[model samples]
Target: QQQVRQSPQSLTVWEGGTTVLTCSYEDSTFNYFPWYQQFPGEGPALLISILSVSDKKEDGRFTTFFNKREKKLSLHIIDSQPGDSATYFCAASAGSNNRIFFGDGTQLVVKP
Candidate 1:
């Protein structure tokens, strides 16, 4: 069975502090990993992604560290601002199928 799992159901941090979210998958066939960020009223938007071929991926203030051998990955938020307070989901999918398995997000709160 294919599955994605995320840790820390919720997180609280002060503005400018960093937070880390973790995820793991059960399927070795999965190749694409994408992390999505979502605000209160809006839909989740793609934040960063990493391919199984690479071990790490970074975009601006967000970074995704992947361990293909262990089927685990982590998303790090650096210099987190209040605007960064949102739910983050770790999703995975195989290239053959359009289906993506999304883990329950970790809700983040950045206090000013």
Candidate 2:
């Protein structure tokens, strides 16, 4: 039960709009939470992360709201821009094997 899943294989939003992506996990043992952002031909990079101890995390235009009790989380992009157009992945790990379970990914396009 170490799988994480995301919804909406793709999304499009106008510039300066807000976009929300959802994620859920099958394992309740998960503790470490991280979100990765990827651009064309580029490797995923850690965007923002939160531990199970915390409920919310924010960085610049990115925010992650996590619900440890429900084993679910979501990412909210505020004032989305063309630059934010990319594949966003939600990931999680149980602090072992150094491996992170990733979502299928949500491709977001911010039109200018």
Candidate 3:
């Protein structure tokens, strides 16, 4: 069974727009949530992350909002650019046992 789930499966946006990706988890012990961005032929890279104690986390153009009580989270990509076209993944960890769970990625397309 999948512990984490992401919606939309895919997304498209024009340059300068913003895209929102949502995720939910089934595990109550999950305390760490990380969002990853991956380009074709490349491995996923950490984009942003949040702890259960934190409600939000942000990087340059990436932001993650977490709701531990609800076991949900969302990733926001601002200023979407052509180069931003890639797959985004939502992941969660319990901070123990070296176990991590990943959601099916959402493919994003940015048109010029």
Candidate 4:
């Protein structure tokens, strides 16, 4: 039941536009939420995160909004730029095992 699902396999946005990626989980035990951003042919790095106890997290142009009651979460990118084009992954962990479950991923492209 440790499955996390993400929507919009790919997204294309113009520079300065806003991009949104959606994710949902099947396991209620998931308590730690993190979003990873990956560039071409590179590993993902942590962007923003929120615990089940919190509802929102923000870092610069990246923001993660979480909903514990709905078991859903989303990442918002503001002032999109070509440099922001990359694959975004939503991940979750139960906080007990420390093992993380990741979504298939959403490929985002910000066109200049």
Give the per-residue lDDT digits (tens) of candidate 2, residues 30-99: 8988999999999999999999999999899999999977889999999999999999999999996778
Clashing residue pairs found in predicted model 3:
none
Give lDDT tens digits, candidate 1, residues 1-112.
Answer: 5399999899999988989999999888999999999999999999999999999988888899999888999998899899998999999999898888999999999999
TM-score of 1: 0.95
Better of 2 and 3 by TM-score: 3
lDDT of 3 at 41: 100
Sliding window of 10 residues with minimal summed lDDT for model 2: 1-10
Instruction: Report the lDDT of model 2 for residue 98.
Output: 78
Backbone clash count for every predicted candidate, in the order shown: 0, 0, 0, 0
Query: Comparing 3 and 4 by lDDT, which wins?
Result: 4
Off by more than 4 A, model 2: none
Candidate 3 regions exceeding 4 Å error are none
Model 2, residue 55: displacement in angstroms? 0.5
lDDT values of the candidates? Answer: 0.93, 0.92, 0.92, 0.93
lDDT of 2 at 6: 93
> How do the residues 3-112 of candidate 4 rate in per-residue lDDT, one tens digit apiece?
99999999999999999999999899999999999999898999888999989888999889999889999999999999999999999999899699999999999999
